[model samples]
Target: MTKAHFDDLKALVVDDNAHMRELLHALLNVLGIREVVEAADGEAGYAALAQYQPDFILTDLAMQPVDGIEFTRRVRLSPDTPNPFVPIIMVSGHTERNRVEAARDAGVTEMLAKPITTQSLFARIAEIVEHPRAFVRCDSYFGPDRRRRHGDSHSGPWLRFDDSAPDVVTI
Candidate 1:
């Protein structure tokens, strides 16, 4: 993708570690994102969301007062949230299945493992820009559609055990 795609984007970097926040800011800059806002933790990140209204968010999984999971939940479920639809990409050193599932269930738009490289970061951003996922809301979940695959020719009830269709709302 071209740098032009990111030229006008604004991002929020939320992490308890100052070093990680700085590193993310620098990486965002290199990718042609000049307007980046940083927050010390998810609590501050939530506040910044209203003031900055960033196009997207980059948050760490672990933090005090509020972790990324809770923050993402608030962003997607809070009545007073400024921008519930804003894309959130959670970054964490922990890539365990449980942690990944938690982030996904909490409404994160994407997940990026820690020790992040420029290429990986760009790839995630590119995916967000190029193929924005439609949001789905159900009694138990309110977030992007969990299913990533589309147009699969394999038609079988085994693919999706639950025949019940989720109420989908495209954003």
Candidate 2:
């Protein structure tokens, strides 16, 4: 597969730790993303979004006052959000299933465990670019479709309420 070019993309890095921000900045630079904005925490990150209007966001999961989950939620749900559709990749040391599920529920496009590698980071970015998921809006959620796999084949009964069953007799 051909390497994807990210020279034109702008990114926002949000982490309370300065060193983590620096590391991510370096990685992003190496990936050819020259325009990067950094925020020390989620609150700052939220403000920066309006000011910088980044094409994507990489955020740490834990922070004071506001964490990455809250950050992603605001970006996706806030009325004044600069770009609700912007892709959000949450990077965190908390790899526990509950934490990961929380991030997913908050609308993160992808999650990368801490101790990130160049290859893994690149793969996530490429996945976002190559297979962008369609956004879904409902009473409780407004984010990318939660379901990752899509096909007509199913081992059990049809689950989607929108899909009509061929064997059902209409009244």
lDDT of 2 by residue, 44-90 (tens): 99999999988889999999889999999999999899899999999
Cand. 1 Cα-lDDT? 0.88
- Span of ten consecutive residues with least summed lDDT in model 2: 150-159
1-171 per-residue lDDT for model 1 (tens digits): 224666788999999999999999998898889999999888999999999989999999989989999999999999899987888999999899999999999899999998898899989998898888999887777889877765443344544455444456899
Candidate 1 residue-pair clash tally: 0
Looking at model 1, which ten-residue stretch has the lowest summed lDDT? 151-160
Top candidate, metric TM-score: 2
